[model samples]
Target: MTVDHVRSLSSGINQTGVRAYNERLLLSVLQRNGALPGGELARRTGLSPQTTSVILRKLEQDGLLHKGVPVKGKVGKPSVPFDIEADGLFSMGLKIGRRSADLLVLDLKGEVRMQLRETYDYPMPDTVFGFLERGYEDLMSALSIDMRSRMCGLGIAAPFELWNWHELVGAPPAEFAAWRDIDFSAEAARITDLPVHQVNDATAACRAEHVFGMGREYRDYVYFFIGAFIGGGIVLDHAVFEGNQKNAGAFGPLPVPDVQGKPAQLIDLASIRALEVRLEADGLDPRQLWQTPQDWSHLEAYVQPWLEQTADALAIASVASCAVIDFEAVVIDGAMPATCRARLVEMTRTRLSDQDLRGVIAPEIIEGRVGNNARGIGAAAGPIISQVLLNRSAALLGALLHKLGSERTSPFPGRTYPTGSVTGMPRAV
Candidate 1:
């Protein structure tokens, strides 16, 4: 179907009350699993068979869902399946980094429709916001989505250290000078009225994996995002574990044993900066790093020791996490190319496997499927899901509001504003 046609079908739904809740349940099931039999969906979502039938009928009629042919089974009658019309919805995602940013438009199935990227000399909030607004506007215009309501909310992936008010209440230090003390949601709201959601870059990437990538295989896992820096996300029972300050997965600061019998943080040992510094000290020109593939290979050799150390540290962390959460695996993702991820996974597995420790099951370490765009894609998907849920709730609220005669402005929270700042920082390598 044409993009416009699909957008129209999705926009036509009256989201609120029972209808909204039903839609949310239906979409959630479809998202978690690409498709399922109507009976299976009812069983999984805990909705009455009659209720499920009604909701499925409405969704199919609205073009948000479609029915599949019956599948033959050995022991029972064939049943028709329901699947999400993924093309019916679309979302935009943006990842803001210190030196560059990536923007992507994705369909409901998590496929990239279009991408635009740019590099910047400095990380100024105002300049970044201007670039983003223009980029979003240009993308929307290109897509011919003139109506704001036709578009879902915007999601941003950024890096911001979350600390308790008592620990670091004032402005952040100079290391994070560019992003310190900025209220992104408040500022972004002034520029556009769209709903904006902010999340940590690694956490967002983890969300993308949980929703669309390999993590869908396990209910609990630790996601290590290796980029300019090293960051991570912890998922338990399919929900992200954001700590009291919403910063539980700051894996960078976790200390690892060093050669000097002291301990250094993972970022100090594994970050891209560490590799760059090592390469420069070895007589390699730093500027050639990004331009030459061979430079990366050479740098890879120099960091082998650090990589091994990182594997050991990760093994320890994995064992500890498993003891507490019984996590199934530890996933490594981010800017590392596919080959590099494979090598790391292999090395981590071998290292952990060699340990003779008792009662320790070496968790599988797998490369992430989402790659560098994981954060951006997750950022994009966040809003689409939020808006879909909100749209459903809004429909029910509208009916109540009509009966109540404006006694309630909305049953939900006030509209969210945007801030130019991206969410979660890259992991501190």
Candidate 2:
């Protein structure tokens, strides 16, 4: 954003009961624009220098922020840039998918510090919770005691109606039916005292992009994540626009054409599960799709057709999405090879040309920066953003982030405004 525009976005009003708001405002501003000296930070947030200095010093003392090396210009005194301390706080993300589950730990800066993965033919609650319990123990034990105490909470990313996919995963009704009674937040409490948060797995991926990837470049975009099931998330006004039900971008059901020109939901034609089916039909190992240090070169002969079909459907979804929101771009990302993501972007761009655009302005089709396992990465960010950082889009979302987890607790406590200095998107750092 231009300096003038960013300055215009600042909201650093300090009042008797607004200390909580001011602290979040400083963090959000730094997250969006990177580190800044006290004066510039104060100017950006419209806070008096004395108040800014007090907040900055207090944050630094509390380990939420750290100062950079002093830089002396042709000006008066040397200025030190204050940045979020990467090791100041930590959060966890758990992503439950149709074919696999991943658990990861991320620092305040949205960098993954540790990760664990488990794969299965299908999902069962016992297995998922088992992994969560084990992974939680292993990860926490690995951290220093100080960092462990700084853990914000856990964020979960799973499907809205996880049981409905029993047919897709080929699991028995009784096994899948158990998910109906599973409350993610309640389950998390059994494993840790940290507050719990949950989001639609696809929306979590979109959140990952919005906080740490190219989604920040646009005020609005439609995000499609091609995973076990082709799902989606929406971003409006610079934030991940999780709708009233936290399922706004559930784009898998968007109508598209099948290989035979028959009507099909985007998921039918685009999901990795369908590709797995094609591979299994040909006696090729579908397990390779989820293998670590992923290398799909040997499977290229089978992958090309799937990419073509998936790209075509995605192009249509992009058009339909933009027809409603005028998104500046359509970001296509997935738990697949980087080569596949780039190729899909190109093919989707080609297919967009074939779409009828009489009333729609075609959005730029772009490859997503956050690659495979984005769902887990995004999930890990939910708790930190919900509590410690700022979410400018919360006004549009109506303070719903706290609902993701069991409870929301701020590292710095006081009443928080729904929106902060960050104009759009949740500031994850």
Candidate 3:
């Protein structure tokens, strides 16, 4: 369907949708607080006890929740605490990067069950699709029929315009240009016949962090994923803030000074591409170095300058971002090795510490736990977030309605919002 048509779909918040929302809320509560009794879940979610019990029963039957040992209270009978069942569902996360393709099968608890990765010069439509198909088949082959049936959906994480960075990626213009006409999510949907969601690779990485990593501890943070190009995402009040164009944290465009003291975007100095450019100038195989940062120890001459420049640019960006929204942490992740990430984080921290802090509280500079897999894992979560975690159709409808600032007749056959409403899109990030 068309984008406008999808947005026009009514957030059917009838009695049925209320149960769905409650089911999600119950899962969220248990996930955040561990096992809790039905009464506690109801109290936390503001759902009626009877409604909570009913939803809990249904979720239990669906294997999405499990009952723990009963706990006897002082004033009441023993109550069984319910917890999320990590194996109840699964999502397929795929990342098509400029240099590599990765596929991961993630369980409900965000654990990776299967991973397949390949390095290539650049992604070609046929090769990328073939890689995904093989990966999906391998994943299904490893699962039972019942488990396979529980597959929530597929999430594709890639750059919005893969062909646009041909120069940075060292790809032929004509070959890379082919990506301009390819619709990644649609093609995957056609091949897999599974619900597909697409997101910018950086945003997907941030979502991965939000759902499985630092997000558990901090709700507000500015996420920077240092891949081929520096990418960013923002989280506020525990939800990713996607701007009108779904590119709120496009950090590559943030301005910074270049080596020549000329004004340039952060991506020019802080991204892996910048390092690659430096390495290439010194007659080293950048592709090999990209895969193995540990080998860069001998190339200290090139590495030191890039690290210094990158740290400076990141410090400036972190200060600017915190000044605007006051994030609690600045998470840096990348396609490079973990040691590289750690060193970068350390350098960034030092640079940030040196900055003047008169009016704004400096956000903690931290290394991202997801690393390079963030985008793929987050993409895999798209289907789960949309189908099980929350009622996205309802949430998007509510957003469109709110944006319009008035009630309008919805063409879809469903109840309008009244019973309940979810506030954010399931796959916005």
lDDT of each: 0.65, 0.81, 0.77
lDDT of 3 at 154: 83
Put down candidate 3 lDDT per residue, 1-429, tens digits, no spaces.
Answer: 332222122112111222355577677666656789988776666667898898889998977888999998898799999988888787788898888889988888888888988778777888899898777766666766556667767899888677888987778899879999898878887666677899888989988887778766776889999888899798875677666777779999898777687899998889888888898887887777655323566777887888889999999899989989889999988887777788999999999988887799999998889877899998998877776675322235447656544433333344233322232222110
Model 2 lowest lDDT segment of ten: 9-18
TM-score of candidate 1 versus the correct structure, residues matched by position: 0.77
Task: Give lDDT tens digits, candidate 2, residues 375-421.
Answer: 99899888777666666453444445444322344333652323233
Q: Pick the candidate with the highest TM-score.
A: 2
Error of 1 at 392 (Å): 17
Q: What is the per-residue lDDT of model 1 for residues 8-120, given as tens digits with 9 covering 90 to 100?
A: 43332224213365577677667666788888877666567888898889888755688898899987899888887765566777787644578778777788888877665
* Position 374, candidate 1: lDDT: 88
Candidate 1: lDDT over CA atoms? 0.65
Which is superior by lDDT, 2 or 3? Answer: 2
Q: Output the TM-score of candidate 3.
A: 0.83
Q: What is residue 182's positional error in candidate 3, in angstroms?
A: 0.9
lDDT of 3 at 51: 82
Per-candidate TM-scores read 0.77, 0.88, 0.83
Off by over 4 Å in 1: 1-19, 70-78, 146-149, 162-178, 282-306, 389-429
